[model samples]
Target: MKEPYEKPLIKKVQVGLSNKFGSVYGRHLRPEIDGVPISDLVSRFGSPLFVFSERRLREKYRQIYQMFSTRYPNVQFSWSYKTNYLDAICAILHQEGETAEVVSEFEYEKARRLGVPGSEIIFNGPYKPLSALKTAVQEGAIINIDHFDEIYDLEEIAEELGQPIKVGIRLNMDTGISPQWTRFGFNLESGQALDAAKRLVSGGKLILNGLHCHLGTFLLEPRAYAKAIEKMVDFAYELEDNFDLKIEYLDIGGGFPSRNRLKGIYLSPEVAVPPLEDFAEAICDTLLSKLKPNDFPKLILETGRAIVDEAGFLITTVHASKRLPDGTRSYVVDAGVNILFTAFWYNFKIELEEDISGPAEPCVIYGPLCMNIDVVAENVQLPPLPRGTRLIFSPVGAYNVTQWMQFIRYRPAVVLVGEDGQVDVIREAENLNDVVDRERLPERLILKKS
Candidate 1:
């Protein structure tokens, strides 16, 4: 006979959550169902956690790749490493058969460690150390030289090695983009680009591969790229005619806009930016019309933000909330400008995770940092949020992690949410020991401590 079981006591927990905009999730801004909560993650790993959605990442990658591949015969995406160089992110892109565009030797080494072939990698940027240039050349990477100094350096290195090194020149054209004439590549009107090409062809140590140029970042205008392509094709034609060398690839450097919303921009994601199809059509039409059918160079795009921006979400817990003397409410979170550097340029829409019926009110969001410039959001209308509430900041997957500063605090862990909604910690939160691992103690200080 089974013994009678005692009545089990039930406990009810009440938790109120809210955002300034009166938007909330059913409970909290949990990244995954049946997965770890922000609070629990902080308990185990700490606060200011960055969570990447693997599903979103793969989806975005496929969308961008398909957008170009479906329209253009030959299209390749070289992931921009400087955007976000997290090993896990790089590995994911590499696993997807995406090539890499590295600006420095360190990033080149990183790509090599990920098993990416140097031939598939495109070495770009204005300033590459001698060691980096030597390594890239020895590895047979497509070196996109930025200026005449770089050209001279490559020539010197090649002469020293007693071999011809293949390289490309970055052309700066009047793409009609904002902040125009920024110091970077060779300007088209200045004749410097032509001079550089001439010097490369005349020099026996260098092999001119192709032309490269990036107008600018966050470029909403597709026509700019179209015009830029027109100029690049003309330059390529000139190089072929002048040097009798066929350009193998035309690397249109990456600056494609991500899903993030910019300040003072009212357009939504659907209409604000031109679709990848538009860019592909422009580039393909321009190149196909300009170059002979047999001379069509392999089109390469070094996209960073558009490929990975939507893939990441930064989740933080509300530490405290208080009403100011001026009757304004201020909410403090575990994250700040350190990790969300893009917040300086964007108005990050923070969403609440719980449902609540309340009028929206203007509130200031502050990070845990003590600096006055550490404000994340100010004078933004938000739903009332109390302490212990979790908030979700979407579309932070691009420049945040790469540009984040470890000021007044250690950085947080980065987790990847799998397709099945399972969470895996891709990067562990930094500990005190991590900050001091390389630090050496003086004998006097050590003696005092002892």
Candidate 2:
């Protein structure tokens, strides 16, 4: 009889960096999520499923809320819809007393359908069509004006409606951050922000109720927010003195960094990112010192990723394994960049569902797409994972669902595990009809096979 079959293996000399640098296993353990085993979840929901923890979501929201509210009076949080707009996730935050912060008309409509009052919604972003504006205005939404055209449009709308409309001016300032986000709002350094405020207040068509500025996304430095708050408060005081306007709220747009390691980062996220309380202290310290006790404006934060990223997980299964010509191990998984868009920039934390002991080797994880750019992780240290091994990719709740692409594969179902450990499908998995239903072919093309 022939010798027992064994998978081909290569023995190579260890060189250069040690395995400890690249290997993430043995240090991190992932046996279950919310007391639900990974195998059970895969069996029940199918492989390549997106799982969200309602308990973690509520915990993070409460943690962040307490961190800020305890430091600053009149603190409010608006769930950033662009981060993760899953109805269940949004509902959880809304239930925790968080308002809705939407960017597009679709998000605005979703908030409304979710029973979020228009007045409680903060309608943001650069593009606001006339119809959306009309709806938002009539619904009592707080619109943050982006550019001069918006000011003129709002003035026209106010004139047409025969009443002065309240709006916030998004001011762009140099907060000493790299690649400044100056494209969205009026430049404060150039006095354009002051000019816009004057245009709104002096014109008597629009009322400037709030001041808003978004520094940048995934900001590693809390001091940047300190700078932003300082400038925003100074501008608010100037507006009150010169324009006789009482700014109702100071909206500091979301830039809080999440606990996800970037692709090029060498240190882990737990080592790199500042704690949530640190950010709170930085912001609150600035606000408390800058504003007088009687003039403290309502502090509104639009934090999204920092609040939800850690609460989500992506469970994928290994479909196949192979060795490259150079004896490098490679894993082909059921999910890829199509669903995990953040994989392009983040080296997401991945964990094996079961414990196994073996010599760890450099591995590249690829998605089940025909494209070559669908790599999920590169040069990660992992032992050989045979076919069907489950891998959990985590801190994925922020942008994956909202930014996922519908190319090649239909998106997977998203399930939310409630606090009581009950699993519910928040978003149904897409099927062939889901893709074809929205697509139309002309009658002539349908009749003739071209």
The candidate that achieves the highest lDDT relative to the unseen native structure: 2
lDDT of 2 by residue, 301-359 (tens): 99999999999999999998877887778999999999999999998888888866667
Clashes of each: 7, 0
Query: For each candidate, what TM-score against the reference?
Result: 0.89, 0.95
lDDT (10s digit) by residue, model 1, range 246-357: 8888888888887666777655566667777777677777777777766667889999998898788777878988777667778999999998999888766566655545
Q: What RMSD does model 2 have?
A: 2.4
Question: Residue 105: error of model 1 in Å?
Answer: 1.4
Q: How much lDDT does each candidate structure score?
A: 0.79, 0.90
Runs of candidate 2 with Cα error greater than 4 angstroms are 1-27, 447-450
